[model samples]
Target: MIRIGIVYMATGYYCRFWKEFYISCETFFCIDAEKGYEVFTDSIELLKMNIPNVSFHAIKDKGWIINVSSKSDFICSISERLRQNYDYIYYLNGNFRCLKSIYSTEILPEEQNGYFAALSFQHNRYKSPNEYHYDRNKNSHAYIPFGKGKRYYQASFYGGRTDELLKFSEWSRNMINKDISNGIIARYQDESYLNCYLQDSEPLVLSDAYGYSDFTHYQGEYKAELINKNQYLGTSLLHARSLLPVSQVKLQGNLGDQMFGFAFYCYLKKFWRDGQRKTILSLLPEGRRTTDSLYGVFPIDITDDIKIVEQQCKNLPEKKIIKVTEKFSSVFYQVEDFNAPVVVFDGKWQCYQYAEACEDELRESFQFSLTHLSEQSKEILNKIRSCKCSVSVHVPANTADSYNILLQKIISDNYFERAMEQMRISLQCEPIFFFFRDECPVEELWEELFLISQCKHHIITNNSFSWWGAWLGKNTEKLVIAPKNWSFWKDTPDLLPTEWIKLPINIDKKQLNNIIGQQILKSQVTENIGLYNGKMGYVLFFFHCARFLNNIWYEEYAEELLSEIYEGIHWDLSISFSSGLCGIGWGIEYLVHHGFVAGCTDDILSELDKKVMEIDIRRIEDKSLEHGLKGITCYVSSRISSPRDIVSTLPFDPSYLNELKEACLRLNIKMTQLTSINDILKGIKTYYMKLHKGAPLWCELYCVIDKIEKM
Candidate 1:
């Protein structure tokens, strides 16, 4: 006779699911085999009860989250005894009920060239490769890149022979502990690790019928199904902890900010109640209709038309509300537990911890819409991808006006320059540096960020835009360097991921002397912004460190830069975009945007628009976005809602396009710069479609994962 062992854990309140599970296993699980039940739990009374072949071992409760991740390790500790006594061993989910007989052959793996492990099917079987919530945190041992895997397996029910199962358990246990040490709990925790293991493990893929749950609404021949926990635990969180049946999430902030709330939604849905659906309380961004595919966690009900949340609350019985703002931003261990039947999270919710909890989902949903890029940007992207070694250095001058100026002290131009130089020296190949200058020569904002993310490594400021771009980057060996000091109180909040290197800003000798008014200062801020001194290297040092000098220094410098620019605008004679007066005047707008000087560069840039009329549009062959006629025209016309569909980045004046049209009309060329951009985007989509299949990154800004199945 074949010997079979059922390894199970039913600690604390989980014992409530034990009675039904025990009866089902004894009656319907491997009837012909000689069976023994190995139970691990905290209930001492279970040992005294004569429950057939069941033998209970007293186990200290480690909580659900810890227990779920370490379940494999627990079995591994007893693997020697299990393998000796039984011909086959399987660990079934504690909450699932075996409704009919499941034979040993159905659950066991057969040898196929090498040892094979058995894997279970996710409730919802079919999903696009990008739709699967693969752990995106490069720091986590569970991370699986976007295109690496095709199957999304459910961890609730899976098992194999004792020897092969031990191999998987040992590997999984080590990865889980490492994640805990790094303070990372991957998306769906244990399940995320299982998917990571199954990515390359061409294991025997079991049918969805074995792990079926009524909540999935997936009709199939069911041998076993996950029973609802609410029937036993009621509304108490002692069983689930940190997860409660949520009624609705109250959303706040602009569209980009509100996207942070989805992570909280993931936690709330962990232990859901019947008739409960993921619901949001705020109005969505204008164009994102319910019909369209959202970033991730799509098909959720939007109670937008109702303005008053209290009025909206009247529909549901729960009156209590929990708001998660910067006040609660210190959350890193886990989302705070809610005791109420209906949990509500309201506020800016700028916490990265929430994003980390559901990082795979966030990466899928908020995948950057790359189709918004220009043809020139796509060419640069191909070059970045073709090169094995590349690094992006992002130093934001725009944030100086908005954030507290004291925050600027934490980073400097010298910090960026040295970081780039060190990367070049350390890497085997000469690294191509893509430096994000103070004034972006490129017109589109998302294109600039999309380009930065494609690079293999990154150096980011305290800004959120770059923080997201760096986090979304899929490079396996990617290195991200960020400034240690961020806030005025000197507290380094849980903003940057722990895996990223945090270094203090190192000011160079020239920049250091510029600050503290030392005698060794290389050049005056006034002289650095001269008409001729605006060369790349000189401008890199001056514009980057300019914020180090007082606001008055930039105010005087920008004023002087534009005062001389008016004289050069008409007589400079050069018609080229990058080398001409047009480039100098274009860069000054950044100084104005940074709050250095107000309204100083507008008239000079406006007058330079007339200078484009003198050049022949047909003769100029350069079509690159950086220094081409297309780039210049887009800059002059102001990049208004190109393909990003978001509001304009530069805040262009209404008459800007009309002014450009007049210039183009004088030369008899149709004002077709926007049409040219759209044409280029079509060609780029053809290329991405070939690479990503039907799911091209450029089709729409968002990937439509309208999967509404109960995950």
Candidate 2:
């Protein structure tokens, strides 16, 4: 029998994948070979439960613990033993699974000029030379100049005769050590090291199918598959402890497109234990100047993240760009695969959970303050508040060029007629309707949208602007009716909330009634006990949700839940981007500086000011973004790392920010209400350096900004 040794490092979060890999290997791998499994893991107790043909190395030695702290370190430690013991040695990733019976002939190195040698599988994502993700940082040992690498080899699957593989392992350890001593990690970590070695030594470059990944859209059969295990384990703790990936995401498309992309980016951050604050590369079309579009619309500070690498996006020399797009309104890339270190996001990524994952941030970014509403708008809001039920119904005027008019016609008059009948029955009461006229004045945009957001419910012609209103609305149990199959080209994705009732264009009133759900059938009549703003707004929120979602049945048990909010002022309450606040007048600084309209009345701001003024922010003790004064201020401070626009800073004067800063003196926070391009660059570089220290490697990318003024 041909003796074979397969090493698997199943330490940390990867521990769960061990048995699956072992079983698949035993069942499908070369049956003729005498296979010996060498397991390197920290989970000895969990892995030792009735397994066979495997020797578990505890991985407890101080030498192993303090070394490279990567899979390569564990494999290198056993290279010598395996070399002396087995005829051939292979190091397989824990996530890799064997699918078909494979003889040693398929994987084992063949005689190359009378000597058995090493072999590696080509990376599935990068194929051509330019697309190869070779380290380009000229400062590192693994650095391969722009166009030198022959083939990009994935480090996940590779093996050879023990003597040859041991030599390869030692070479990798030396290169990694050198890179570490110089404080520069090769791009993609050990993968770059492997690619660097494979470039010169012409190993048998197998096809990409040998090491296929689940995310790869290719439908071809493969030997081993790379699958996700997050569904089976607690990823938060494991991912947090593992080596930080040198991954960077580059978003592509327009402002609206990026809004969805950024949300997905935020989702990736949460999934990988990396917050969305890290500067991501924003790749736009050539000649498009990167604009500070987040401005007041997003809950982001310019100084916080250094995203966008392309200096004007002119020199298009980026090695690899794995573009992700939607196919028939379906997600092109799995949400889980998005967490990988390097990927390009393009087109519309309307994954429902993408928004839900970062819903708090999204809400906070779009917050609109009471004072920010104009006098006319405030009146409209008051009316919305007074109504027992307010439902926004968006409709565009006849315009030949616009898509909305076309879609509106597609839904036709019958859709609205049915919607009206459905609304009446669902609410079980008369409900007011709001519209979105195509010719509405630009100046009235904020007021119009603010009025829409205040509404208890929404019905719409396909419109992104109005869709945002429903997204930012306050009612947890509110009704949102959208025309199903609104587009002509493809089946529309669930861009709206799943609970939001969807009616086919020609559906009968009876069909609509059936789809509206039982919860909506019951809760149309609100008591209107209090206005939906300020502290009292919270009570109404629970009351609203309690009627439909019985999760909070003990709603009446609270003792003075309103005590914490700024004295009994009416505030619009909704889910917000961050935890701090979502009421009309809440998170004032964040709302004003980020995106929410700050057009509030003096009474509202004055009352909120009193709450912060009364407390010594540091002494508040609650180190949370919601309750503590210090926490609230810190949350606001953390957002404005380096913003480049001042228009959103309007109405909420500099004096207001000063008062906030004065309230939290010496609290290690920066609330600079104004930011310059220089400030933006400096902040971005500072952020990059921090990542360089901890994560070390960065993909070569460029952020294109065409609209911003160059300093």
Candidate 3:
């Protein structure tokens, strides 16, 4: 019997691919070292455990293993196989897998009478000539002397008789060493050396079936078909190189970072190509007169919202204008007529400095009415209105150090508590308070402002959004409390109304309390909380809760609210919801459930579908889905004291639960019910089991559950 040895080394993400390959090979043939199918690797211990059927040999020689270049691994593996006196040795990349069984005699070079056996490279998928592989001007040792029309071979997979393979490895090593000595490494490095050596040796040629293209250029299913078709053609091995499907490969460390960077670059390139190309004319009146289109490069960072800027520009009339930018500096509200002598607004916060200047205009231009509230929003609003007084709080947790320090100072000075205490004393009743944290979206910020504008009083920080909210308030007798020092620099009195209270940044809590107590005793405050009764309010509240709690249920509820709102108006809500949920974590699930629920509109069935879809069927680490379920169960449990009340209100029919199971099976999500707090706790545990230890979401969910258990 002819002895065959396959040698490979996998260090990182390649380990995952290697496991698949080893399993596939074992399925086809008996991969035993004593039985001639010997495996060699640096990580023998890992391979031994993962592939128990295969006998592994550890490569102990440090001199032969080169970390900088993969080509060195190829040379080392071949050398080790030669020393072991194997009849035939195959040097395959860790990513190569055997799709079918093959005898050693079939791959051995009989007619060619040469050592190495490799398949000729296939046609380039990108429609470029093969000559693109080499630089003709470079005089490197590994540079192959290319003929006009000769086909090249991939060095990813190759096999040969022991002696011939040794000779080939030595030749490659010498060529690589020579190139290194001359300070000239070939572009393809080791593959270049192999090709150069092959030019002189003229080794046995296998069919293209042995080494087919499996890169991103090729479709996944089609590539899989091609790989399987090779098995039918009596070809055993298929080389995938490093281009394994993302679903199959679990990337780690620098490889994952590099892939993310590459993906980001691709995303940026696509964004640039598809981005709006309109030019904003920032013309100065005294500047040189020219008809030429002024081209200024706007450098965009990752944080910049290109879509928002594009949307803002859409409102302006399409024209170039010259204006004195210094006189009318704020372009956000003034750029109504682009052709007129007005400031040209590029989508930036600096432009929004004068957003307050045209508050009435902005309000009229945009839809901010509360005439169509959803059922859920109506409920939440009623809860908010139950209190005697309402106060909106804005805390910038994710802002710059200056703002964060300001927030810390306010917290330390007991500003928030003092304000709440004053409101309670002043109203002589329980106050309803809303906290706007850092992660709140811009749209939600506006909604919060709209809601706050309807409140009896407002306690805000040095935030522009809060300022806009206070300014937009319908309450003429509204008590607006703000920080004395609005910024790191001196306060700008013009930014706030003279009637507003400007308290010191670091106010003495005892002194302020006494002053606020006296003011409350003297003043006659008689304003009630306003309730939102519009679909917009409901939609806004749903999204706000979704983001704040990081829950998918609220997101889905928001989508459902939009669906209802659109159906009411006879408008297509799918288009708007699709665009809005594009980058959102639970977008895909929401869309899937939306379509499924829309098709099956029975209330009971829809509720079951929602619950089924809410479970992370993807089996991926989706924090949104986890937190969403947690938040939903938490909210439900808190609102309804009795489990029977929850079941009756959000009833889950037994028949529908079975249907939910079937739906979850189809969607691949593991469905669980929140029949009670116990069920929610069980789900938390199940999710915790799936999550890795010390993962941020894992810790967060653990803490949340732990708090609930205590409660």
Off by over 4 Å in 3: 29-83, 111-113, 124-132, 135-137, 146-149, 181-183, 214-711
Better of 2 and 3 by TM-score: 2
Two-way TM-score contest, 1 vs 3, winner: 1
lDDT of 3 by residue, 1-711 (tens): 666666565543344555676666556432343224345446745655644334555543221122223345455654764567577776666556666554455557764557678755445434443454653425677664445324455666776877777777767766666554443435555666666666656677755455445442333221111233234222211112211111001111121121222222232222223111122222222333221111111111221123323333333343422332223212222222121212232221222234334445444433354554445445656755664576777665654333244235423647667766666676655667876554544323334545655666788876655665565566666677877655432224345566777765543434423432332232223121100123433344345445544667756766765565444432121111111111111222232333322332233233323443344423423223244323323222222232233335543345544554454455445544323323333443445446532222212222232332233
Model 1 lDDT tens row, 207-247: 75676776667777888777776665654444333232334
Give the distance in Å from residue 295's predicted Cα in candidate 2 to where it truly belongs: 3.3
- The clash count for each model shown is 3, 35, 8
Error of 1 at 102 (Å): 1.6
Candidate 3, residue 258: Cα displacement in angstroms equals 30
TM-score attained by model 2: 0.37
When 1 and 3 are scored with lDDT, the better candidate is: 1
